[model samples]
Target: MPPTAHHPAAPPRLDLTDTLVLFDWNGTLVADTDRALRATNAVLTHRGLPGLTAEDFPAKWKLPLAAFLRDLGAADPEAAEQYWNRALAAEPAPLRRGTARMLDTLRACGARLGVVSAAGAAAVADDIRNTGLDDRFDVVLAGVAAKTSALLSQRPTRPRAYYVGDTEYDIHCARAAGYLAIAVTGGYRPAHALAAVRPDAVVDHLDQLPGVVTALHAKTPAPLGGTPA
Candidate 1:
C-alpha cells in the first residue's frame, strides 16, 4: 500500500546549507521517456516480445532493468546486456524541464549534488558532458543495481541527505537508505503514481524542489525505521 502524506499543507521553507541531493537519471533529471520507450520497443521487437505502449511503459517499468528484460523473455544477463547496449546506442534523451536551473540553484545555495543511476556510467557521463552539466555534480555513480546499497555505501548515516526521483522504486530506495525522498511529477510516472509511493513530498515541476528540500531538512531527520516527519 502507498504510504500517506505526513504533511498536507504548503511545503515549509528553511535553510539547506549543507545538504547533499542525489538524483536518478532516466526519468528524473533527463526527459527520456519517449526515447526510452522507443528503444525498449525496438529491443522487444528484436527479441520477439510484445512491444509496450507509452502508457504501459511507466506503469510496468522496473529497475535493475535486467529484471524487466527477464520478464520480457531475456534468458540471461548477456541477453539483457545486449538489449541495454542497444537502448544506449539509440538517440540520447534531452534534459528534463528546469533541470539546468534546478542544478544551478542548488549549487548556488551551497548544496552538494550527485547522480546515482542504473544506467551505464560511461553513457551517463557522456550525457552529462554533452548536456553541459558535467561541472554541476560532484559525483556521478551509475550502473547501480540497487540504489539503497549505493546510498549506504556513500553515506551510512543520512543526515541532510535527499534523493529526488520519479518512481516508486526511487521512493523505496530513499526510505531504505534513510534519505528524504522527493518525487517529481514531470518524469515517466504521473503525479498520482508518484503520490502512491508516499515520498516526503511531490512536486509538479523541478522549480519547486528547493523549497521542499529546505523544508524537509528543517525537520528532524526520520529515524532508520520510522516514517518521515
Candidate 2:
C-alpha cells in the first residue's frame, strides 16, 4: 500500500527557508469541485452534449483545459472555455477545509510558497484577492496551458522543491520539473488514480502538509550554498 496521511510523521523542527513548495489551485487548495463541475456541465450543455453528474465529474476531470473540452465532445474548445469561465465566475468558491492551517504551518516553517494553476488568469487573480491570500504566495502562475514548461521556469536552480496537487497530470508535471510530487486526496482524482502515478507522497487532507514537508525534508538532500531556494 502507498504511504498515507495515517503515518504518524512528526512535523520537522528544522527551518525550511531553503525549501520551495508549490501548490495547485482549484480542488487542491479550494473546495471548488462542485463549482468546477457546475461550470463543466454548463459548458457541455452549451455544446449540446449531455451534462456530467456529480458522481461522474471526478472521472471526467483532466488537465490542460483544451483537452478536457475535447474529451467532453466540445466542437469549439474556445467557445466552451468562455462558457466555463462565465459559469465558474457566477459564484465564489470557498477555500478547502484546513487550507488556512496548512498555509500557516508551511509559512511558519519558513518555506517559500507558490500557486500554479491551469485556470483562467482573471478568475484565479480574483479568487486569490477575494480570499485575502494574494500576498501569501511568492509566485502565482495562472492560465498555464503548458504547465511543465511554466513550472520548470519557476525553479530553474532550486535543489529541493515540491509540488502538491490533486491529479495525476500534476504529478507528471512535478516529475518533469524535478520537484517531489505530493498528491492530496479528496480532490479531482481518487486516491487509486493518483497512486497509479506514483507521487512521492500522498495525504488525505491539507492540514497534514506540515508532517509531509517534515518527512520530505529528511529525505531530500541538503541544498548547496545553504541559501533560501
Candidate 3:
C-alpha cells in the first residue's frame, strides 16, 4: 500500500508552512476544469468549430478558453466570446472536496493562501464565494490574464511560495516565477503527466496537501527522480 501522509512536515524539515501556498483553482482545490471543458466544447462544436477531444485538450488546457478557441482556428473573436458566454449560462458544477476543512487546516497552521488559476475572475470569484472558501485566501488571482503575473506580483512581499495545480503548465508557470510547484493528481491531468514535470511534490488526495507543502521546503526530498524542480 502507498504510505499515508496525514500531516504537514515538521520544521528543520523545511518550513513550508512559512511560505504562502498558492493554488490553481480548477484542479488544485476544486474539480471543475473538466466540467468547464465539457461546457466549452459543447458550444464550440455547435457553433461550427470543432470540439477538442481529450488528446488535444491537454495542449489547450492552460490557455484561456477564448484564447484556446482562437488557437484552434476560430478567427472570429466575437463568435468565440459568444460561445464562452453560452457555456457560462450552464454554470458547471464545482467539485469542491473537503475544501472548507482543508482551508481551515491551512489557516490554523498560520500559512497564507492564494489561488492562481486559468479560470476567469467571475467564475473563480463566484465559486469561491459560493463555497465560502474565499475567506481562506489572502490573494485570489484568477482569469487567464492574471495567471503568471499574480505569482510574480506577490513574490516581493511573500518570497517563499508554492504553487499547487493539476497541469504541467502550472508547474511551468511556477518555475517561471521561481516558486515551488506542487502538482496534484486529483486535477485536470493524470499523475503520470504531472509527474513527468517532477514537481516538488505530487499529491493524489486533497488531504495530502500538508505533506506536499512539507516536502516542498524539505531540505532533502526523498530524491525527486523525474524532472528538475
lDDT of each: 0.74, 0.82, 0.67
Poorest stretch of ten by lDDT in candidate 1: 3-12
Q: Write model 1 residue lDDT over 80-137, tens digit each, in one string.
A: 6556756774567788887898788777777678899987777787788878998999
List candidate 2 stretches off by more than 4 Å.
7-13, 224-229
Query: Tell me, what's the RMSD of every candidate?
Result: 4.6, 2.3, 5.7
Ranking by TM-score: 2, 1, 3
Q: Per-residue CA lDDT of candidate 2, range 56-80, in tens? A: 9888788888789888899888778
Q: Output the number of the TM-score-best candidate.
A: 2
Better of 2 and 3 by TM-score: 2
Question: Could you give candidate 3's per-residue lDDT for residues 39-139 as a string of tens digits?
Answer: 66876777677787766665565455566667767777446755664565357456556666666666677767888866667777777877677678888
What's the candidate order when arranged by decreasing lDDT?
2, 1, 3
lDDT of 1: 0.74
Candidate 2 collision pairs? none
Clashes of each: 0, 0, 0
Q: Give the distance in Å from residue 82's predicted Cα in candidate 3 to where it truly belongs.
A: 6.8
lDDT of candidate 2? 0.82
